[model samples]
Target: MKALQITGAGEYGIANVPQPTILDDQVLVRITLVSTCPRWDIAMLGGKDMFDQTRPPDYPLPPGFPGHEAVGVVEAAGPSVQGLRPGDRVAALEHLQGQGAYAQYMAYRERDLLKLPDTVSDRKAVSTELLKCVVLGLDQFEDVKGKSMLVAGLGPAGILAIQVARLWGARVIGIDVSPERVAAVNALGIGEAVLADSLGDRRFDLGYDCVGAAPSVQNVLDRTNEHVVIFGVLRGELIYRDRFWMNGIKLESHKARPVTERYRRLLLDVLTRPEMNTECLQTKQISFKLYAEGVETLKRQEAVKICFNPQEAF
Candidate 1:
């Protein structure tokens, strides 16, 4: 099996590795498409540990690391694996322990895989992890039927936030620092998309800070009327001003909620609707061996997410 590995900072190399053996509870997934996770992919390639930017990244990360989003066919299933068999289409709903999504195939526990509904295509199914994040985060909030929402960043997650919030009946408004992203979101017309700073004095019933930066979080905190949820990874300390507290505003960070059976059903429901735009992150596809080129495209803002095809070399 061929797997991608990071030999050093700003480097990508393909290695011929041993094919994984399936455990009794596991299924072997023949990876068809693997997508880039900007946070981990860009950070790792830049020599920074995404978990702790303060520390230098360790070299030679596990093969197929930092490439978690994937959808593939099950080539084989262990005898103990129930409800799954070879040729069943499945998508990884969670990042595997080794991030082995970058390889040609991976052996994953049945619990971590979702059997795809026939209506869902590979492109839409591939981004279930992102959808799961948005769903679980919004699940933390009270019903948003008539509420207004402020999504503080317009990246992939932010884009999904706007659509999901609207679908749940919130009057959605989103902002982003990148003009290109702003234009892209505006084109979708899912909500009021504009420059992040342009929201000046507008207020919303709820705020979702999708950019994990302090400024973006603070910007959300300043404008939200009822509750603010921090959806972005916490990279810096947030300043909750005394004035904010006096206004009776509440703040909550998104917790990784357990993937329950109901949530699994909800994901399938969302994927069935094209309006949710589950796979909006992807922009282009390249061979798995050319992952470095794909990363460069992401860094250049030429693509939002790159899909790597392991079956093709050129």
Candidate 2:
């Protein structure tokens, strides 16, 4: 088997490796799609510690590593694995301490895989892992129906937030510095999308910040009526006005949940819906041999969602 191996910063290639073995509670999956997580992968490739600050920087990430969002068909199941078979189509969770989904085969705990519905296509189902986070973030807000909500940063998560908030009956507004992103949101026909600088005198009952930068957090705090949800991973300190306390403003931060049966069912229910618009979020699909190129495209902000097809030849 060939697996992706990052030899150093800005360097990677395929290496021949032995296939993974499944444990009693695990299943072997033949990977079909591996989504690029730019923030984590690009930072690691550039020799930075963005994903986990506590862990010291490790060079040359292990073979078949650096991917979390993935979907595949089950090739084999361990004796203890139940409710799963050799032909089940499922989404995978990243095994942080083990080999990941960026390979032809991976061993996953049976509980970590979410079976895809027949109504969901491979392209749409591949987004289940990320969409679960968006769903969880939206679930944190209360009484959103008929309320005004602003989604900051029109990235993939931001766009999904816009759609989910709208479904929750919120009058949604999207803001992004990039015209292309705003245009893409507008194409969804769900809400008003605008340039961040052009949002003059505009405010919302709630604000969701998809970009975790300090500036993005400050922007949401300034324009929100009272409640703001920090949905993205923040890398810097956040400073706000002293008057923030006087206004009784509330701030909430969200992190993706570990895959569990309850959350898996919730995610699959949403993914099977036509309103999720999962396909629109996918921007490009490339062969596994071009994984580095796909990561480069994401780092340059040239694409929104890029998937590597491990089954395809370069």
Best by TM-score: 1
Best by lDDT: 1
TM-score between candidate 2 and the true structure:
0.92
Candidate 2 lDDT tens digits, 1-314: 77788777777788888999888899999988877766777776666667676553476677877777888999999999988999989987546366866788888888778887777888887767678788778777766899999899888888788888887789998899999878877877756899999989988989899998889888888988778889889767876667777888888898566666766766777777777787776799887667677778888778887887777732
Identify the runs in model 2 with alpha carbons over 4 angstroms from their true place.
Answer: 52-56, 94-96, 259-261
Q: Please provide TM-scores, in order, for all candidate models, with all chains considered together.
A: 0.95, 0.92
C-alpha lDDT score of every prediction, in listed order: 0.83, 0.80
Residue-level lDDT of model 1, residues 205-250, one tens digit each, is 8989988898889888888888998988877788888888788998
Least well predicted 10-residue stretch by lDDT in candidate 2: 48-57
Q: Model 1 — TM-score against the truth?
A: 0.95
